[model samples]
Target: MTAREPRLLVVDDQALVRSGIVGLLEAAGLEVMGEASDGFEAIEQARRLRPEVVLMDIRMPGLDGIEATARLMAMPEPPRVLVLTTFDLDEYVYRALQVGASGFLLKDAPPDRLVDAVRTVARGEALLAPALTRRLIERYLAAPAPGVLAAPATELTPREREVWQLIAEGLSNHEIGARLYLSEATVKAHLTRLFVKLDVRDRVQAVVVAYESGLVRPGAQRATH
Candidate 1:
C-alpha cells in the first residue's frame, strides 16, 4: 500500500508567502489541509482539521507564532510545528522552539528543502538538527528567557546531565547511544526521563533547557564521561 501524504496547515500573515508555500507543497505531492493568515486562525484551523504538521510564520497579527505554537502543543494531540522566518537569527524563532516547535526553515530556502522539512517533522525527527540549533541558541538565547530555567542544571543526575549535554551538542539518540555505549532504547528511556525532569515537551525544548541552564556552552568541547 502507498503511504499517506503528510497533511499540512500553512500559516502566514502574508498572502503571497502562504500562497507560494502551499503551491510548492502541493506540487511536491503533500496534502494541504488548509491555510490561515494569522496565528489565531492557525490555531482554529489546526484544531478543526488536525493536520500532521504546521508551517508557521513567526510574525502574525492576532497571536504570534510562538504563542500559537504553545497553544497548539497544549492540545490533546498536537501537530508538529515547523517555523518559517526570513532571517535565521530572528529572535522569535528561538521563542517558538522554547514553546515546542519541532524546528524551523528559512523562508527563502529552496522549495525542495521546504518539502523535506515538512516530511522530516512528520516523521518525528527534529528539523533543525542540534548543531545549527545550538548556534542559534548560543547567539540569541544564551541569556535567560522569561520561561526557561536558567539555573536548573544542578537538578539533573550525572547521566541525565550528560545526555542533555550530548543533546545540546546535536547528537541523535542513536549517536548518543553509541557515544555512551548504551542501546538506542536505553537512550530513549533516558530521554523520556530527562524530558519529565526538565519539563520540556521535546528534544528542541530539552536542548533549550541544556543551554539556558548552562549545562552546555557554545564552543566548549563535549566530553564523554
Candidate 2:
C-alpha cells in the first residue's frame, strides 16, 4: 500500500509566494489543506483544518511567524511547523525553533529539498543541516532571549547526555546508534528519557536546550565517526 501524503497549511503574507508554495507542494502530491496570510489566521486555520504540517513564513504585517509558531505549538494537538525564511541565518528562525518548530527551510531551497523537508517534519524529524545548525546557534547564542532559561543538564544520566551531545552535533538517531555501537531502538529509548529530563517537546527543542544549558557549546568539537 502507498503511504499517505502529509496534509499541509501554507502561511505567507504575500499572496504570490503563498500560491507558489501551495502549487509546488500540491504538484508534488502533498495535500494542501488550507492557506493563511498571517499568524492569527494561521492559528485559526490550523485549529479548524488540522493539517499534519505547517509551512510558516517568518514575517507578516501584524502577527509574525515566530509568534504564530509559538501559539500553534501551544495548541493541544499542534501540527509540526517547518519555518520558511528568505534568509538562511535569520534570528526569527531561531526564535521559531525556541517555540517548538520542528525545523526550518530557506525560501529559496530547491523544490525537491522543500518537499523533502515537509515529509521530514511530518515524520517528526528535524531538518537542520549540520554546518548551518552550528552557525545559526553560534550567531544567536551571543545574546540569549529573556525567559528562555537554560535547562538543567544535571538531571540527565551519563548515557542520555552522550546521546544528547550527538543530537546537538546534528546526528540522526541511526547515525548516533552506529557511532555509539548501539541499536537504533536503543538510541530512541535514550532520546525518550532525555527529552523528559530536559523538558523538551522534540529533538529541535532538545538541541536548543543543549546549547542554552552550555552542555553543548556552539563551537565545541563534534565527535568523529
Candidate 3:
C-alpha cells in the first residue's frame, strides 16, 4: 500500500508568500490542510486541524513563530514544525529549534528542497544540513542565552553517549551506524533511549541538548572511542 501524504499547515503573515508556499506544496502532491496569517492563528489552526507538519514563518506580527512552535510542542500531539527564514544563520531559527521546531528552511530555497524539508520533518527527522547545523549552533552559543541550562546527560549509558556525540557531529543514523559498527536499527534504538533520557522530542532538540549541556563542544575535535 502507498503511504499517505503528510497533511500540512502553512503559516506566514504575508498572504502572497503563504499562497505561493501552499501552491508549491500542493503541486508537489502534499496535502495542504490549512493556512494561518500569524502565530495566533497558526496555533488555533494546528489545534483544530492537527496537521502532520507545520511550515512556520519566524517574524509574524503577533506571538511569532518561536513562541508558536513552543506552544504547539506543549500539545499532547504536536505537529512537526519546519520554520521558514530569510537567513540560514538567523538567531530566531536557533531559538525555534530550541523550542521544539523540527527544522528550518531558507525562504528562497528551491521548491524541491522546501518540499523535501516538510517531508523530512514530517517523517520525524531533522532537516538541518550537517555544516549548517554546526555553524548555527556554534554562532548561537557565542552569546548563549542567560538562564537556559542544559539537561544533564548523566542518565545516558556510555554507548548512548557515543551515539549522542555522533548525532551532535551531524551524522545521520545510517552514517552513525557505519561509524560505530552497528546496524541502522540498532542506532535508532539508541536514539530512542537517548531522547527519553534527555527529555527531547527529536534529533534537532537532541543536538541542542548536546551543545547546551557541553556534552559536545563546538569546534572541539570529536573524541575517538
Give the range where candidate 3 is weakest over 10 consecutive residues by summed lDDT.
143-152
Q: Which structure is stronger by lDDT: 2 or 3?
A: 3
Which ranges in model 1 have alpha carbons more than 4 Å from their true place?
Answer: 142-157, 222-225
lDDT of 2: 0.88
Model 1 residue 66 CA deviation in Å: 1.9
Best by lDDT: 3
lDDT of each: 0.86, 0.88, 0.89
Question: Model 2 residue 87 lDDT?
Answer: 92
Could you tell me how far off, in angstroms, the CA of residue 209 lies in candidate 1 after the best superposition?
0.6
Between which residue pairs do clashes occur in model 3?
none
Which parts of model 3 have CA positions greater than 4 angstroms off?
142-152, 222-225
Give the Cα-based TM-score of candidate 3 against the true structure. Answer: 0.93
**Candidate 2, run of 10 with poorest lDDT:** 143-152
